[model samples]
Target: MNNMIAPSILSADFANLERDLKRVSEAEFIHVDVMDGSFVPNITIGAPVAKAIRKHIKGIMDVHLMIQNPDMFINDFKDAGTDYLTVHIEACTHLHRTIQRIKEKGMKAGVSLNPATPVCLLEPIIDDIDLILIMSVNPGFGGQKFIPYSLEKIKQVKKMIGTREILIQVDGGVTLDNAKEIIDAGATVIVAGSAIFNAPDVEQRIQDFKSLML
Candidate 1:
């Protein structure tokens, strides 16, 4: 399989977002990290910004909701042009319903797990999800170290979703150093923040990261 590189816009220059988005055109999708103070202790953009982004970028918007009540905003996000809407398994009170709601809106539903969240917790609901986002660092921030244990988590989740055709995604601390390792461990999609957005030559960095997937 050809691995995917998704550059997170959280670490990009918010003032010139379109320019930054253009710089990472090689990316399979634009990874948007939505954080509410209650869920991850940080506040970021919501529906309006997401809508504006959709109008400017032609790539897929893989929106990750790190908020407490993802169900409350699922419809809004889908309407805002989110191609894939992922909610934290820990945040949703009714994961199946939320996933069903996302599909009902005609978007792919994904399940995201924090670094401390166990992979086994997904066994019961794995069949309902289109993708699984494994956070290599805690959800609140970006540019942190890729937790070594996430590789094992990816392997286990990949195994659990066997023959179901679920895509496995890894977010946080994805850099050239370990991009290959994560893919080798079974992640089809990789989300990078500082490694791609903060690089001196942003476009080259994306290509360099993409090369590692080979």
Candidate 2:
């Protein structure tokens, strides 16, 4: 399978969002981190801002909701033009129902696991989700170092997935140095924040990441 890149907008220049979005236009998806301040220590943008961002990006809007009770705002996000909606497995009380709701809204349902969370926790719901996002760093912030153990976790999840069509995505601290190893470990999608937005040349940085898949 072809590896994909999703550039997180958390590290983007919010004041010049249109230009920043254009910079990463080559990416397969645009990762929108939605933090509610309760689940995560920091609060990022919400559905309104996500709707605004959808208007600027050319690729799919992949929204990762790091919130408490994501069910409450599922419809709101769906209305915001989210192509893929990912809820934290730790936050969802009824994960299956939430995943069902996402699918019902015609959006790809994805489940995200924190760095500390084990891949075995997803065994039961592995076949249900369209995507599995394995966090290489903790969920609260960006620019953190990638946890080395996440590569092992990706390998475990890939073995558990077997012949399933579900996509395995690795998020946080994805840079050129680690991108190849992450993909080699079985991640189909890579989510990068600082590595892309913090770079001097955003388009070239994306191209560099794409080169790893080659």
RMSD of each: 0.9, 0.8
In the range 1-214, model 1's lDDT, one tens digit per residue, is 5688899999999999989988988788899999999999899999889999897666789999999989899878988999999999999888889899999999999999999999999988888889999999998998799999999999999889888888899998888989999999999999999998889999999889888887
Q: After superposition, how far is residue 127 of candidate 1 from its true place, in Å?
A: 1.3
TM-scores of all candidate predictions against the true structure: 0.98, 0.98
Model 2, span 92-184: residue lDDT tens: 989999999999999999999999898888988887899999998988999999999999999999999999998899998888999999999
Error of model 1, residue 17, in angstroms: 0.4
Evaluate model 1: give its TM-score.
0.98
Best by TM-score: 2
Kindly give the stretch of ten consecutive residues in candidate 2 with the minimal lDDT sum: 118-127
Which candidate should be chosen as best, given lDDT against the real structure? 2
lDDT of candidate model 1 versus the reference = 0.91
In candidate 1, which residue ranges exceed 4 Å CA deviation?
none
